[model samples]
Each structure stands twice: as structure tokens, then as C-alpha cells.
Target: MSTACPSNPRKRDRESSPAEQWRNLARTVPATLMHIGTSSSVKAIRSTKNAKSAMKAAKRSGDLSPAGKPDASGSSWPPEAVELLQQARDDVSIGLKALRDTRDAIVVEFFDAWKVLNQNR
Candidate 1:
């Protein structure tokens, strides 16, 4: 992250600027937690916000829900939050694979049609 956002040192550097020890408490805590056994990252905040905004827009346009209600019944889903999260992840994985397969099929069909036309000519 530091390498990717070299220009945006938004987080206070804890290791660097050793001279700041005198006013360590005065400085805000650095957000470089990824290195310290925590995969929690600052970049995920932006991604979460972006996804929320996109879903909000989709909902408003009636794309996500025409009735503006929950898509599924809670009874059908797992009661535990962890299980629900895993189910959602699996849904996304399956959707992505299906979309990729559809795109590949379309491309193959187009290429095959072009090849047959050339052969006939």
C-alpha cells in the first residue's frame, strides 16, 4: 500500500521520523496495520464506500429491487452472520464464473461464424 500510494501518506508514519518521539502522543496513530498481523487495510474503506454508493444508485433505479425490499426471505438463509456472509461470497463467485463463460461463448460463436463465412467464400 505504501508503494502504491507513495504520494498519499495519509497515515502518520510510526517508524519513520524518529525525531517525533518527543510528541508521539500528539501525532495521530498510523494506519499501517497490514504488516502487524492484521489484514485490515485503509484501501478497503474506499472500496466499501464505492460499493455502497453503486448499490444505492442501482436500488434507486429499480435495478436492484423493483419493490424496494429485501431480495430473499430470512427464513431461507442461514441464521448466523458468518454463514450468510459465506453464502453471499459464493453467490458472487458463481455469478462471476457464469458471466465469464457467457462472454467466452459469445466470442467463440462470433469467431466460428466469421470462419465459416470465409470458408464459404
Candidate 2:
């Protein structure tokens, strides 16, 4: 049985060079990781919301601390804590969108890079 060889070995070589592979990865890997991080952050936000809801349910059911204690259901958080959570959510949303945009731009760059490299052949 005979195996078929690539018709254009030089084109294949250029496409699969170590430098080209590295460049492709340099463009792709971080964007993929950032996407994963964004997914995790959104999941965490959902978990936080669920936990808050459960806490409220517990408090209403009288399973929480008595009304007079420091940790009582009636207790309130300082403005700082509330602001911090809000800021974190906002920051994550902004960062995730930015990362998505960056990924899109990188995709365009990849297309352009490949087009240029192919044209050079």
C-alpha cells in the first residue's frame, strides 16, 4: 500500500512551523483562558445570588440568629461591603466583555495573518 504525500510540502511547512504554531497559540490560549475565567465569574455570581436568597429564606423562617444579637437577621452590612460587591460584579462584566472583544479582534488578526502568509508563498 502506498501513502500519499502532501501536494505542496512548502505550504504545509509554513503553516505548521514552530514559530507559526507559537504565534497562533500566543493569540489563542490567553483568549480561551479568559473566556473560561469569565464563565467561572458568572457562575460565582449566580451562586452568590442563590446563597443570598437561601439566607433570606432562613432568616424569614427564624432559623437565623435571634433579632437582638449582633448576627441577627435584622443586622445590616456597611456601605463598603455592598459597594465592593457591586464594584466586583461591574468589573467582572466589563472585563468579560473586553476579553470577548479582544478574542474577536484576535480572530480577525489570525485571519489576516493567514491571508498574508498564504499570499507570500
Candidate 3:
């Protein structure tokens, strides 16, 4: 068996410096936040649609047996599902608010740092 060494040394690209990485992260964080906003919007819409459909179905069935109430078992609608849906909405709201706040803070910090750097020059 013979061991062979490669003749050429590969050089890695150094385009991604720390500053560049931070810049990329700053850009990506906002995009990620936007994505989260969109996803939450979609989920909210879907949940609303599902809730409406369930209500319509119940209305159509005319099942007044009280036991026929879709939410009687607390499995799908009456209390648990409603509470869950509300919680989901609240969670998304809080998350978006937090992301927005974080993004604003990052932006302010970046600008302040930039000002300091320029002043030092």
C-alpha cells in the first residue's frame, strides 16, 4: 500500500470575515422575522377557516342533543380548541413583537457602533 500526498494546497475563500458575517446575520434576522410573520398569518387564517367550518357543520347538523356539541368533550372546539387557538394567536403576536423589538435594537446598536467607529477615525 502506498500513501499519496496531494501536491496542491487548497485555499479557502476569506470573503466571509467577521464583519461580513455580522452583516449577513443582520440581514438574515429580519428576513427570518418576516417569514415568521407570514407563517403566523397563514396559520391564523387557517385556524379561523377551520373554526368557521366547524361552526357551520354544527349548525347544519342541528344536533341539539347537547352531547352533539362539537366541543362537549373539550377535544375540538368548545373550550379547549378555542383556548388553544387564542393561545396560538397570542403566542404569534408576542413572537412578532419580540422580533420587531430585537431588530430595532440591533439596528440602533449597529448605527451607534458605526458612529463611534467613524468618530474614532
Among these predictions, the greatest lDDT belongs to 3
lDDT of 1 by residue, 51-105 (tens): 4554455344443333454345533322343343444455455545545554565
Task: Provide the lDDT at 69 for model 1.
Answer: 46
Model 3: per-residue lDDT, tens digit, 1-121?
2223455446533454555655866776667656656665566556556555555554444344346655545454445445645555565565566556655766775675566445534
Query: Which portions of model 3 show Cα errors greater than 4 Å?
Result: 1-76
On lDDT, the stronger of 1 and 2 is: 2
TM-score of each: 0.35, 0.37, 0.38
Across 1-121, the per-residue lDDT of candidate 2 in tens digits comes to: 2233489655433335655656876787667656765675666566556555544544444433344332433245434444444555565566566556656666776676567557636
Ranking by lDDT: 3, 2, 1
**Model 1: residues >4 Å from true position, as ranges?**
1-79
What's the lDDT of the predicted structure labeled candidate 3?
A: 0.55
In terms of lDDT, model 1 sits at 0.42
Task: Give the winner by TM-score.
Answer: 3
* TM-score sort, best first: 3, 2, 1
User: lDDT of model 2 at residue 71?
Assistant: 46
Candidate 1 to truth, TM? 0.35
State, as a TM-score between 0 and 1, how close model 3 is to the true structure. Answer: 0.38
